[model samples]
Target: MSTTGHHAAHKVVVIGGGYAGTLAANRLRTRPDIGVTLVNPRPEFVDRIRLHQFAAGTGQATADYGTLLGDGVRLVVDSAERIDTAARTVRLASGRALGYDYVVYAVGSTCAIPASVPGAAEFAVPIAELEPARRLRARLRELPPDAPITVVGGGLTGVETAAELAGQGRGVTLVCGHTLAPSLSAPGRRSLATWLSRHGVVVLEAAAVNEVRPDAVVFADGVVRASALTIWAAGFGVPRLAAASGLRTDALGRLLTDETLTSVDDDHVVAAGDAAAPSGRPLRMSCYAAGPLGARAADTVLSRIAGTAPAVIDLAFTGSCVSLGRRAGLRQFARKDDTATNVYFDGRMGAMYKELTCKVALWKIRREARRPGSMIWIKGGPRPGQPVADGARDDHGARDARC
Candidate 1:
């Protein structure tokens, strides 16, 4: 909440404290000339990828920000309400206003709850955020073992949640609107389905849920099943704060930026993570992508101040590491364009790989906080104005999951 000196003093404000926001602030605070202030609602850093484990009653979803943020950066525990680009001021929920020379709009997404599906919002338990996931875990513990728990959606989040709940000896059923993991290779999908069946999880493909009732879920075909506890892992949607602020954003409410991750309307602003629609093609909202995007956003600001050319945002997905549960998982290896290759690792080895990835995500942030500019994210050295071939953007993971 402190900004000293005059107008010439460089200052940057990063809204949101998710992986992208955290990394951007940590990286930018390293520069002695610029001051960085991070705005977030929570005091802790929530590991969004492991939120399923939190809902399953097996893992912790938060880390201490003291260990992940740089010493020079100021942490503001407040939510952003609006951005006045003309004034270079950010309005906070606490009725305070802060001016910035540059701003990073990283206010991450929220649960994508379907409105067409009646009762889904009232009956289904959503675990996308920390507080809701904690409540879901608490609610699951209150139910008996024989209580039928319905998990809607077939994406990575739904699959991981179903496995974790089933491993805890709960009666679980997965209702995928379509085939499971459409983003994965056919072999990869087979492996996941087989493992789910082995654990006694009922997999219902193409069984779209039309409604969620108090004690049961009604399918599109009018069939009803007992669902004492319903967990919704459908999809995620970004908040409309950006659009409400009059910034250029897509239909999904993600801020529109170019290949540089810089705002098309204002050079004083940059964006990253799930909240950014770069060239109208946003990357998959994962911590993996967030890490590099955050790095690129910070680098953009530094290069602006230094009067040097900033690098373009060029990234490729190598593979996807998914955790089925605490015991088993799948690692679907892919090419630069994110098409699933024949290579993969499964079973305990796969689980171990996913675990290491989550750990590495945190480790990278801490390392960057201690040794700023130490992060070594892979970059495609595409010449300026050249269209870099980004990874395959097609995803069939979660069409039903959202806030």
Candidate 2:
């Protein structure tokens, strides 16, 4: 690949159009020295964290990447088939080749559906992507008015889905393999359970799903009769793009990256979002981490292009929010070090807070798209302190004061 009449410097290519890749591309557009191109299969960036909301009959879930991208950034709507790190070039699915001086792999993650579960492949719907979520929502609406709905996996997605379905006057049963929100504190989990029960969701904790059928789910204890609508939100698995490209990856196929989110043993490649595993640390797959990691990855790329060592990437969580339908939610606070903090908000107010958080996440991305590097203000605060940071604290205080 030759630049021809173009500039004769370094070229950067970023894979994926999700939160991480979009942010990284926008940030890179700020620099005039480097030529940047973003390669993704989709023309639009889907709000993945809100996929459940879309499935549960909420707002639209897709955003135009063209609107989000900056003027100088080139958009390549194609999948990366192969990456020759030694040759410093990438082969796309469209048979075109792109040579890059630096590459950022933010392809995101996919749902790992177990093959052992019968009928799961045919019937179970995974809300990991926008299209699937939209299809699931359409199927759910077509079901009988009073049909029984079963949601497998008691994690955040399952709980939220169950709550939303139940809120729509459908009988929902949330089957938890072990516990609901295992990352949450004990009190937070209990509050989640209570809220689900209150929302008419029959939560069965510690009930492992042995198999899924078209009209029923077989658990370890017994079988739960259900309708045609079965949702699977068990776990996340990264795509094999990294492994296929001959890069270093984990057992789950996530590209192993150093502290600065650069690919190990390959400084020319970097990764962010769910497709990246930071060396020596376990970070949960959430949009919270994706947004920050995206920015950090961009910073690293820019620093390296500027002939400087990239800064070390560090992510600290503030809190986690789970919405139980549109009426109730739980906000779990965490310490500055990302440890669980004994603070939470429940009931209607909590639901409002959760909605606000979703809006803010999308807003932050859109704001950055409109004005690159504007989200650096978020780093000034003390790791965002979860639900107790400024507005959240005041809201909690006001609720407590009223109580």
Candidate 3:
């Protein structure tokens, strides 16, 4: 008989259904002794990385969780209002209470447009979530042709949105607070710049947007430009449930975890995805790190249940893939720590590669959904006594802190 067959089913509740939460829940199914419950705000899975594509109307962002989650896991469609670590229960906004032996916090993140910026919260549309993407799509449909559409921030999200809209023939300007794709290599930026120019996107460098008016963006230097539609993709931010629940958060409300991905305050609680900060060192907010973190979180629970010590987290990133319209893209290579390397795959080849990369990411999720514990990530170097590094933190934590 299997080890799982001899034990009572352990109830594991995973909050949030983004990349990390889904992966962790599905992976937990590997142990038949575990009864996994996945709680999500939406019934369907949102491919957050492709929200720009969804905004551009190139593809849909949602998938039925029924087909994406493992059969061994129960799906609860509701918002988690509070987590009671002492009782190992999660209270849902719908007045449902869920009991669990282990709780995985993975509520993901959102765009970091500051409410302090005048008119920003009211005027700018962020493509981080489904509703905002739908609103942006609706706005795009209503706007007149040849209207100026301004995309704020020069990060990957802004670049992709600008490129996608520019390809659709909307007059587009990208307001880069400092530099364009600062994380990209020189060649990578050159290729991106070429693509943007080909798509007729005006690049604004070092223009800090101080205020967002109804019809324009005012820069810190008092320069104002007309904008028919303003898309805010500046940064990412997390939710506040961890802090509200009295969990120890690192100023930004991310659940603080030890190197083993176990919550510092509660042994029954663990976190993955954008809501996790491991040993004060978080992974990037991107799916590049979230997928692996989800799998690692499951391993911790599995190891603990099997009477072995859980392995420490060792996440290493290889590169970043950004799509510049459907025809162009950049696969900027990076060091294991996620800093840019001189090497890259660019242009048409890069686009094809990025397409493949995205397919693979979804494939990973689906594959695990069908066969839990099948998806895994590259293991880092030998675990050091003091493993956390300041520079190697996840991007999500950085975005959360800004919010």
Tens-digit per-residue lDDT, 273-367, candidate 1:
88987887676677777888899999999988888988878776677877877989898877655567878889999898889888999999898
What does candidate 3 score in Cα RMSD to the true structure?
A: 3.7
lDDT of each: 0.81, 0.74, 0.79
**Model 1: lowest-lDDT 10 consecutive positions:** 394-403
C-alpha TM-score for every candidate: 0.93, 0.89, 0.93
lDDT of 3 by residue, 1-403 (tens): 0112113478888999988899898898887778788888887898776778888888777888876876767777899999988887899999989888888888888667787788899999988788999999999989998989999878777887888888788899998877787767778888889889888999998778889888998999898999989998777678999888888887666789998889998888889988898886666677777888899899998888888999888876676778877887788877666667789877888788877877777788889988888987776633334433333222222321110
- The runs of at least 3 residues in candidate 1 whose Cα sits more than 4 Å from the true structure, single-residue gaps closed, are 1-8, 381-403
lDDT string, candidate 2, 78-100, tens digits: 99998889999999999999999
Whole-model lDDT for model 2 versus the true structure? 0.74
What CA RMSD would you report for each candidate? 3.1, 6.3, 3.7
Worst 10 residues of 2 by lDDT: 394-403
Stronger candidate by TM-score (1 vs 2): 1
Which regions of candidate 2 fall more than 4 Å away from where they truly are? 1-8, 222-224, 377-403
Sort all candidates by lDDT, best to worst. Answer: 1, 3, 2
lDDT of 3 at 199: 81
TM-score of 3: 0.93
